[model samples]
Target: MDFDLTILGSASATPMLGRHHTAQVLAVGRKQYLIDCGESTQERLIEQKIRFSRTDCIFISHLHGDHFFGLFGLLGTLHLQGRTEPLRLFGPAGLDEVLTTQLRCSGTPLSFDVQFTCVDTTQHQQVYEDAAVTVNTLPMRHRIPCCGYLFREKPGRRRLVKDLLPTGLVPEQLQALTRGEDLRDDVGHVWLRHLDVTEPPPAPRSYAYCSDTVFTESLADLVRGVDLLYHESTFLHEMLERAVQTGHSTARQAGQLARLAGAKQLLIGHFSSRYRDLEPLLEEARREFADTNLALEGLTVGL
Candidate 1:
């Protein structure tokens, strides 16, 4: 299965030269889940050739305009395009009201059902789950009630050892063996030993996202040991005090968080518009975590 993250936009507060806002898509297997819908998200999706029908779920980290202002536009486009599948939206309080008001004022009811789940930004809990993965909320310290998201892929079934299995084994028995379940014949004689017939499943993969929040050491444990981590770095280390006051993180602080969490790789984005060249910010983050990478628009990272 293809597990990767594609960046649509990676700017902070406002769009600039080559950067838009904060938007990303997490593709797992054949499905795609949008993380945030910043400005021109629909255009970005079209530009990237991502089908609107594939995104069944959307996770908004916060109410900040830079993080989710483009959500309504995308939904409207989807409605116009004749999408009938239900969409599951997870976000902080008042999101439903915002979207509803816009739709109501425009007198355009959606063709699809929208299921909204209000998230409690103060708690850590599993908010959504499917056969392939589970999503949890990550509490964050910010100007408002905001939270991040953690995506964990489910463990797969054990692999079968076909060479050792007898040729006459039925499909049902073979399925049991592959699932690591012991199989027996009608007389209760052991037909297959699960351990001997199959190898253990691969470990689950995980990804964490943190955006528009102040730097906090406690977050290290919340996103510990993830395969990939995408965190916001809206300013340079020189503006640490300003970053704290604005409820934002500096590049160096983002790197520190990844290092403390022991993440395999760190992705830094949400750059302040003040920066024309982000080389300094990248250098600052790499000083603390060598595996750090920049979150540029259209960049895709495999997990």
Candidate 2:
């Protein structure tokens, strides 16, 4: 029930004072997912008191060193700690080979099952799904073959209005009534009012991640109307040209993307080292979208 997203690191490739590289921890319904682990990601987890054993899957946006350098160290630590739970990784092509070769060269052996799936961003299909949620890849404009991710929880069962029911209703009858089934009496007459006994299911929740991408308008179509959105804002509007050159988005652009996508809330991070203060970034983003917030390391967004 505690669905949230915790920011671990929010810096670009370059490391700055008080800023770590890219990493995010998405705590879904009952599982934690590591998104884009950068350098010292494991250290961040320890600092936040997050158990690495809780992470069931990892989604690497791209092969950029800043986005995935800490992966080997984390894997090594997992092996050393004797992890037995199955771990899955969703990344771009050749990620399986890259990680396998790294582990092979380092002579680190894993005690658990590790599965890797290559992401083809060109297609907008369901890449990973389960009974609880379904995740899709949202490709964006970046220097490399980077793509965003969309995490959506499936709709669950409807709520039952127990107080209105009679006290003598048995558990089996209650179960049938909750399932919208009509209960028949001895004479075969309907005894339960399905409409009056049940409430509609809540809306499905969704979170979209758009990190380390340039100001690409195409992404709006994929992330539109998302419940929450985390987009990279590496620079202020003053560095618009630099942001474009480096395949990054300015704070204003990120806000615009969020607004264009009709996101309920926007989280901006991946600050440039030159920025000693983040007021300008916040100010620019607020100009476009008033619901925008900064993605601080310890900050959490409950969805």
Candidate 3:
């Protein structure tokens, strides 16, 4: 199974000279999930060569323009492309109402159904689950109703040691071994034990996306030991007061949160436009968390 993340946009509040807004695409196996559709997100998707039809779900962290303004355009483009599959949309309350208003005003009947799920930003709960992955909401402290998302890959079956298999074993016996079940003969005699023939499954991988959130220590508990963490670093530590006032986190704080959560890798993005040079922000975060990296547009990370 392949787990990858592609950053589409990383600017905070507004688009900059070289950066767009906040948006990303997370690929879990064959399923693709869109997180935050900021302005020009469709263009970014096109640039990345990710087909729109492949994206079955879209998650909006909050109602801020920088986070979800591109959703209307993306939905409209999907209709134009003749997409008929139902698209599942998860977001905070009032999102459905706003989307409905946009559709009504434009008089564009979509070809596909938009199944909306309103997430409670104040609660930590499992919001979506499939055979390959599970998505949970991480309550965040922001100016408005907002929440981050935690994506976890499901555990796979045990692997069998081909050399240890008995001669003339049927397909059913192999399947049973993968399920951790002992194989017994038709005469009720134990042929081979599962533990001797199979190895433990690979450990599950997890990724956390925290966007436009203020410094919250409680978040560390929710995403402890995540393989990858993408936290918003909208300002440098010198501007900590402004970051707190705007419900955003500084680069150093983002690094500290990553360290506290025991994340394996940290990707810091959602940068404020005031800083033309981003090396300073990256350096600041790296000082706190040595494995921290800047989340740039068109960058893909594999887990």
Candidate closest to the true structure, highest TM-score: 3
Best by lDDT: 3
lDDT winner, 1 or 3 = 3
Which lDDT tens digits does candidate 2 get at residues 1-303? 666999988778788766898889988767888999999999999999998898888999998898899988898899889999889999888788888899788787688878898998656667888777789998867888888899998886667887777778887887887677878989999877767788877778888888778988888898779999999999999899999998999999998998999999999998988887888999999899999998878788897
How large is the C-alpha RMSD of every model relative to the true structure? 1.2, 1.8, 1.0
Clash total of candidate 3: 0
Ranking by lDDT: 3, 1, 2
lDDT of 3: 0.94
Tens-digit per-residue lDDT, 1-303, candidate 1: 778899999899879978999999999998888998998998898888988688899999999898889999999988998999999999999999999999999999999999999999888899999888999999989899899999999998888877876678778877888777898779998767989878887778899999879998998998999999989999999999999999999999999999999999999999999999999999999999999999999999987
As for candidate 3, its clashing pairs are: none
TM-score of each: 0.97, 0.94, 0.98
Q: What Cα-based lDDT does every candidate model obtain?
A: 0.91, 0.86, 0.94
- Candidate 2 residue spans exceeding 4 A from truth: 176-190
lDDT of 2: 0.86
Q: List the residue pairs that clash in candidate 1.
A: none
Candidate 2, residue 67: Cα displacement in angstroms equals 0.9
Q: Least lDDT summed over 10 consecutive residues: which range in candidate 1?
A: 161-170
